[model samples]
Every structure is written in structure tokens, then in C-alpha cells.
Target: MTTTNKNIENIIETNMMGYASYVLLDRCLPSIEDGMKPVHRRILYSMYLQKAFNLTKSANVAGQIMAIHPHGSTYSTMVGMVQKDRHSIPLLVGKGNFGMYTSRDLMPAADRYSEVKLSDIAIDMMKNFDKNVVDFVDNYDGTIKIPEVLPVKFPAVLVYAPSGIGVGFSSSILPFNLAELCDGITNYLRTGEKTILVPDFATGGYIVKDEAVFQRINEEGFGTVRIRGKAEIVGNKILIKEIPYSTTREAIIDKVVALNKSKKLQEVTNIKDLTGLRGMCISITARKNTNMDELLEKLYKFTPLESTVSANMNMLVDGLPKVLGVWQTIDRWLVWRRESISRGLTYDIQKMTDKLHVLRGLEKVLVNIDKAIDVIRHSPEESIDFNLQAEFGIDEFQAKEVSNMKLRNINESYITKKIKDIDQLEQTIELYKEILKDESKLNELVIKGLEETKESFSVDRRSEIIELTQVKPVKLVEEVQDYNVTLHLTKEGYAYKFKGDQEPMLKPGDKVIKVFETTNKAEVLIFGSDRVAHKVEVKDIDDTRVTSLGTYLPNMIRDKKIDIVSYSVLDKKHKILVAVYSNNRIAKINLEAYEGSRKILKNSYCLKQDLVDLITLQEDTKLKIVTDKSKLTVHTKDFNLTNGRNATGVYASPARILKKVEVA
Candidate 1:
């Protein structure tokens, strides 16, 4: 025998694909036909089979379900959590502490402590099991059979939404009101109109209906919705009556305490949770100076009072995972339902046909009572059935039934009852046949069942949908008014601003090299030794006392040992400027090109060894240079404006060292 090694990538791919298929099909995703995963379906089926619809111990139910589901702990928790949920029509009615939706920490007691029973709604999902409406496959041990999917009479997916995380995909479907779901199905069937659905959470909250995402969800079956806890400010406290769907009383209190400790919730002084499993009630006391509205907004910003619910309409379609739109899901469900109902009717018709055969055989016996008695009394028991079949033109099954018939069944009154039963059975057979043949009749039956289910399980929508107004963003810094201001810079590298107009108070060694008049709204540019230009907004420079030293130049420009060579106030009307470097290079460029914020302005330019001076200039303007050795002059048109700030310019002067450059 020869042994071969498989490629590592191929092995990994095969393993991962198998794992994903298991997670998607058996664990996470629900069947669209029944809206239940295998575990949930098994739990319900076990209860139905055991006739444990009364208050059966949850542990016993779990034990029964383990025959089908191997993992006891996980299914126990799932059963406890799902049964206690008050939002949709619960599949199981549970007693005792079945945990809660508000707090994940408060887990329900061990399954032995909790009692559970199936609800009427859950029974309806398996209504036609005995009638052969759905297919069943062998159980895990092959000891028994289990349904592949329930023959659900109505749409359970929309009413009781699913949320699960899987291998590569997950789903978070929101529950809707039962009445609305029924109406939607009816309307969709009647006029081919798609019904719009909104989330109706059991833990009542407010939904921002005007959000564009909600509209997209209704149209495409995937989007996000914003939910806020119901809150009101009264007196000195804000009372939250209900929190978001996933939020809990304990969690909300913890969040508030954490926010308060961090000072993020400035107005909140104390927090308390008076919530129970029934509903939410949280009270937060505010400080004396708190603005109630702003306090609530802060809470919403920092706490779980507001949250988002995502919609991902992923389910099993034809035994494959697929994301469907809203109408597409409804349409597919209707088709499945039509087929199931049709199969059920066919099963019923066959049953009636079988009964009519037996009745007709009995009718023959009634016509010839004496011959029937002789055939039954004198004929050998083994041959009696064959004799009866031949004599009465009946099949083997009917003949066997006659041979085994009791004496009471042969009386006159019993025969009359058989005749009436045959007539009724014949009528029932015709009705079932008609229902199967006509499509509209089938649709009407579906509509009727949906309406009846809605009546049995419908409740007022707990979540309120409202068009929330978009809140404007608040600015962190206040706006400043424009006013006349004077800027002064010294050769010693001191920069200051004065209100109105004032002369710089310079020390004996210091000299005021540049003084400019600009408004508070103006942006002042500083040329540095590092071949970079820095900008400062005039409003940021506070007015200084005449006797005090000005703000250090390094603090303003972010460079040390660098004196201000020249400074200019950017003007909207004048976009051109000229720069002269100590290396005797001169360039003409747009002033707007150098415009940047205080931090970013440093990298805006490149220079030679040092910067000589920069001046605001206009197009077609001429420039002059006064050098240490000599003077050189040229027209601005001698060179073109360079687009890049780092570009070294053409020489404006022949002198090796230039002292100053100015407009001629």
C-alpha cells in the first residue's frame, strides 16, 4: 500500500467548510419554513410529545429534550431565556425566576427549579404533524423520528425575531407587532403589496422612525435603527421608565455610576434602579444648577439609555443560507405554507377514501345478511377473509376489517350510522379536493388562519416610533468678534498683540523689527529659520501689558533660536507674495499657498540656509534687492510663480549675500 499526503491548504479548506456548514445549518440559522433552529424545535417537540403542556419541571423538559439535543446546559439556558421573554408570543410558559432581559448577570436558577409548559401558539406550529403535512427524519440515535421543520400555521419569524452569531455570518432580526404582521401578510397576498415592518420591542422604548436606515430596512431587509429609553425630567430628577431592548436595570445603573465617577455625567449626583422584571424604572438625581434637558442629553450620550438594533434577514432557504428582502421572505413563506397545506388536504382525502371503502364493504354485508352469516360461521377462519373479498368485490384490507368486525357492528342501527358516516365522509372528501384544486381558496384559508392567530396572540406595540429631530452639533470654542488689533515683533524674538494701537515697550538691547495693523480675524504668518512659515490667528493672541515681556517667539512658531525675519497678514484681496532667502534666492508665489493652521504651517515651506524676508505682493509687481556688497533689481515678470513652496527660486540679485528685498 502507498500513503500520500494531502496539501495543507486543501485540508484546511475542507475542514473549515464542513465546520461552517454545521454551524449554519444545525446551530445558528433558523429554517424559514418554521422560524426555529434545531435546538428550539427539539425542545418544543419534546414537550409536545411528552404532553408536558402543563407546569412541568424545566429540568424534566431538558432531560426529555436531551434525547434529541445532546448539549443539555446550552439548551437549558436557551429554554429559560426564551420562555421568559415578554416581547413576542412566548413558546413556553415558565414559572419561577426564569431570569430577565434587563440583566444578564441574573441567570435563572438551575433547570430543576424552574417549571415550564408549552403555549397555545407553540402547539399551533405543530398542529398538523399527525396529518403528514411535514417531513420527518431519523433522530440522532435512529431510535425515533423528528420533524425537519414544523408545519407552522402562521409566520413565526417576523413575530418572534431571532438573534444569533455564527461562523461567517450572523442574524439580528427584530420582532414586530403580531397584528401588524398578520395585516402585512394579508395585504401582501391580496394585492401583492409589500408590508413595511417596524420593531416592537417588549422592553418598551422609543424608535427614531425618520431615520433613513429604517426605510432601507423596510425595503432591503438590512439596516440599523436607533432606540432610546423612555425618559422624563420632573422636579430635580430624571425618571427613565423603560430602557432600550438590550439594556438592563443593573447595567444602566452601573453605566451611570461609571459615568458619574469619570465626571462625564456632570449633572448627575446620584443614581438608583427601581426596576423589576415587569418593566424599567430608574431615577437619577441632578445637581442644583443642572439644566434638565442638557442633563438628559448627556445621559443619553454616555449611558445605555440609547442604543442601536441591527437587522440582518439571514435564514435558511432551500437548505442554504441566504439573505432575503422583506417581501421576498414573505413570498417564500407563503409558497412553503401553500405546499404544506396542500399536502395536508391530500392526506385527509386519502383517509376519507379509506374509510369509504370499509363502509361500502359493510353496506354489501347489510344487503345480504344471510349469506354473510353463513360465510362467517361455516367458512374456515383462515379462508374467511379471502371468501369475503371475492364475494363482496372489496379489497383485502376492507375484507379483513369485516372478518374481524364485532357482533354489535352488524346490527340495523349500526348499519344506519355507517350509511350516514359514508355520506359525510364523501362530502368532506369533495371539500378537501376543491381546496387542493383552487389556489384562491388556499390563500383564503391561509389568511383566515393568520387572522385567528393574530387574535389569539396580539398585544399593543410596546415600542413607540417617532420622527426624532436631528440635534445640531455644539461648538467647543465660542466665536470671537472681529476688532482692530496691532501686532508687534522684536528682533529679540518677542511677539505681542495690543488692543486698539500701542507702541512696543522694548528693552535696551531689543529692537522692534516688525509692526503691523490687523484685525482679530486676520491670520499672521511668521517666517522661520527652518525654511518653514508658521501661522497664528490674531484672536488667539491675548492683549498684553505694555511693561510685560511678550509671548516667546518659539511658543508661537514652534521653533527655537529663530528670530522673525518678516511677518505679513494674509489678505483676501492680495493672493501673491515674494520670498527672499539668505542664499540669495527669490521666489514669487500665491499667499494662499502658504495658508495653513498653526501646527501644519511649519512644513509648508522649504528654505536655503536662512530666510531673509517675505512680503505680500501683487501680480505684475516689480521687486528690488539691497545687498551687502551691491544692489540688484528685477521686474517680478522676470520669473514665473512657483506652485510648490519648497522650490528654490531664481536669483534676484548678483550679490552673494542679500540684506533686504522689497518691491521697487
Candidate 2:
């Protein structure tokens, strides 16, 4: 055997041992391809059957899956199947609590509460059943029952993954939508090459850089694909708007920090804290001005902010492994789908036709009941024998009976006329089958038949095909009343005092102020000898009582010489006699009296009473002098005499001598 053949055999053996298998060719045995072990696959198959065929409940679908798949089926699995129908496959119809892609915590609802229906897209794809585009498998008990091939209609989208083992290869293909898969296939078909930037599953982010890589994978089964993401720049700062698939938020943050510390991204001041982050929005501020484009390029080249996905088109088929290109996978799937539909349709059509035949025969048998009754009544001795023979098509014995017995008008002969209607019914059944061969033609025939029969199809038929258009509600912005207490200054930078239970702590920037009342009344002096008596009035005191004296005065004095003298009348009245002091000496004596009834105060020393009283003198007085004597001095000075008479220098030779003498 060739080396390749030997390798194939070993791969097959490895697969049988529950290990990875490597196949030399792309095709594998039908049994192996159809026999997938994963619970996810089984669930998906169950949903496809139910949704595509319009089954009503998850429990029902689960029951069917339990019959074929080796794994024990449960309500949860059924729920997951229903979700996979809606999310993994685009054709899935029906609604209720499918899991969320944004988070992994969402588990599908239990089967009991959930309902199932086929989507229009799904129903259309169900046509593949007629085309025999899928394969079927036997039940767990070896009953020929469940479908082995997935019946996907062409131009239809199926987002599903298949898992299996081979000698040296094993793989898990993640789910992808129909549109993207079609785009990938179309690209590959045109250029003999295609590459799909790997999609981020949990986050649903995308990175598309080069189409050629995806195209190459599509055509050649393996290629390296490059994907770049959006990098936004505000001046010197770089902000990454998105990241490539599979790059976690933590991973992105770590990469950024590492790059900054390593000096790969120079002048990065610091990495900010990321907490309670649902999605990442990083801001990379530069300490100094830098070329933004150049920095972004550096980030792409040096950081995990960008990454690549390797497209490997290697999958298991029929227990064998094959490396397939993008086009190859699509093409293979297309062929498989076509064949499965053909076989399924052939089986279903033949079954329906056979049922129609049975019904026709039953109608004929019913019509012959009168003949049967006549034969029994007339030939009671041979009734059992005649009945058996006639029903089993025994002509010889029936002919003898027909000739001898006088046939009653409503007897055996009458039954024969009614039985003749079976031929016409059979003809109608044949016409219906011919029409059903083409769906559009069948639809037309159905409409015409409805008019003729004046009967509507079942409600189930109406739900089979629907026109889908999603209408989203338009959101209107609502005006909300916002209440806020804002501090306003009166051009003096003084805000209204905010009262609190205790005196509020005051700071320079604090916008609130607190005021407290002084315990003692502020005294106003009217005249030196007369004390002004005034009552304090407090107003607008918050959270504190205003006493009659404005506040509680603990250390207030009414008089120095006389203690509460003649304190009268509850209305703060007083009469007192005290000596007025000036310079610590009694300047005058006064009698002061306050009368609350007259609202008047009298002082005997008041200036208005008498000017002489205001000019009163003290009993003892002394003058004090202040002088700097040490710095002063008195001196006597004499103007002394002497001006001596001098000689004349004029006149003579005498003159010279005289002149000289005079000059001297």
C-alpha cells in the first residue's frame, strides 16, 4: 500500500479509538459523517427538524432527539436547541428567551414554557427535504428513523459547528452567520481564494484588513488573515475604538501598560484605572507632542492591540479527515444538501402517494358494504365463507351467488354502483401529486382546489410561510425636571447661611456659611454719665430659639455701683442713684430712673435738664505734666567786645611806609 493509503488507514483506526484522524481524501463513509458525538450538534439537529418542520414545543423536539442521539436529552438541552435554532441558524423561527451573545451567563429557558415555530426563512429551507439534501441515522435501538444529514436549503444560512476526531487532526468550527459565510464563499468563488477575518464571538467585534487572505482560505483551505481595528487620535493622545476578535478587555489593558513601561510607546504619563468596565475605551495621552499616525502604526506593529487569525479548512467527514478550502467546504455542503433533499422528497412523496391509494381502496370497500350485507342475509350458511372470499377477491364463488339470488334494488348490486366512484378519486389524487412536484404549481393548484372544494387549508399551513419585516419603535426624548440647590453670591462672595444641626465646618472653598448668635447683648453708649438701655431683638434665627434678651446672657451687668437697684415692673424698669466717675474720681452725682409705663428714662444730671449740671466739677483734681528734661539744657552766653582800631594805609611815602603801615 502507498504511504498515503497507510496513513489513511491509521487515521481511521485512530478515529475509531476516539482520537484525531487524518484522512487522505475529503470524502468519508456516510455512517461516520452522520454519526456526530457532541451534544451541541444533536441539539442543533433537533431544533432544525422542529423549526424547519414547524414543531410546537421544545419538549417535543427533545423527545425526538432522545430517540436518536446517544446523549441523554433533557429540557435544558431542548432549550439550548431552540436557541441554537434562532441564533446559530438564521432560518429558525419562533421566539422566547434565546441566550444572549454579550454575556455567557444566559441559559436558555426550560422547554415547558417555550414555544417553537419555523421562520419563513426556515420554512423555505425546509424545501430541501423534498430535494433530499440531508442524511438520516437510525434510532438508538437500531430503528431507521432520525435524519443523518442536515437538510439546508441552498442560498440558505446555517451557522453551526461540527466536531470530530481523526488520527492526527481534530477541530471545532465556531458558528457563523449565513450572510458572512455566503460572502466568504462568493469571494472565494470569484478569485479562487478567500479569507475571513476571524470574528470575535463573545464581544462580536470585527477586524478586516485584507480580503485576499480570506479568499485564499476559501480556495486553498489554509491561509493567514490580517485584521486591523480603528484607532482614534485626539491631538497627541491615541484612543483605540475597537480591538480584534478574542482580545479580552484585560488583555488589551495589560498590553497597553506593558508597552508604556517598556518605552515602546514613549512619553506615556500613566495608565489609568479600568474598573467596572463593560467595554474598553482606552486613552493614551502623550507627555509630549508626537506624530499621531506614526504612533498608531507603532501600536499596531508592536502591541497585541492587533492580531491575526489563521484560517484552516480542515474538518472531519465520515470518520476521515480532509483539509478543505473555503470553496471546497461550501461546494461539499451544497452537494450534500442537494442529495439529502432529493432522497427525503422521494421518500415523503412516495409515502403520501401510497396513503392516497389506501384511502381510495377503503372508499371502494365502504361502498361495497350493501353487497356484503345482501350476500350475508341470503346465504346465511355460507356467509362467513362468502364474506372472506369476496373481500379477498375470490371471483369464482361470488359469480355463482350473483346469478342465483334475486338482487334487491338496495342490495349487493347497489353497493357495486357506489364502489365505482373510487376510480375518479384515484385520478384526483394523481393530479394533486403532479401539482405538488413544483411548489409554485402546487400553490396555484391549492388555491384553485380551495375554490372548488370551498375549504380552507389548516392554520398550520398559514404559519408555514410568512413575510418578515421588523418594525422598531422610534424613541422620543423626554424632558425631565432637574432639581438642584445652587449657591448664588450677592457680588460680595457671601452666600446665604446654610443652617445645620451643628455649626458647619468652614473652609475657604466651602459654599455654605453658618451664623451663630452672641450670648450677650451689644451695649450702645449714649452719653458718658447716662447708660443707654436698649433691648436686643433677634430675627430669622434658624434651628435656635430667640430669647427676649436676643440670646441667653450669662455674664451681663446692669449696674456697677447699685445691684439691681429698684428693679421694677416685669417690663425691664429700673431706678438707681449712683455717682458718675470721671478719670477715677467722682465728677458728679446722679439719680437715674426708668419708668416702663411712661416709656421714659430720667437722669438728674442730664444736660437737657440743666447746662450747669452738665458742667459740674469733680471733688478732687490734680494736673500731671509730662516732659523730657534730661535732653534739655539752659546756657548763658556773653557777646564779648573788641574791635581794634587799625591804621590807615593811604597817603604817603609816607606813602610807601604809610601805605605799608596802613595795609598792615
Candidate 2 lDDT over residue span 383-475, tens digit each: 655553566454443434433444353354554564465566566556555654654443343233223222221111100111224423221
| Candidate 1 RMSD computed on C-alpha atoms after optimal superposition onto the true structure | 15.7
| Candidate 2 TM-score, C-alpha based | 0.42
Model 2 poorest ten-residue lDDT run:
655-664
Candidate 2 segments whose C-alpha is farther than 4 A from its true place: 1-37, 45-147, 154-158, 161-167, 172-177, 180-211, 231-241, 267-291, 362-664
Q: State the lDDT at 481 in candidate 2.
A: 26
Please give each candidate's TM-score: 0.69, 0.42
lDDT of 1: 0.77
User: Among these predicted structures, which one has the highest lDDT?
Assistant: 1
Q: Which candidate is the best by TM-score?
A: 1
Error of 2 at 549 (Å): 69
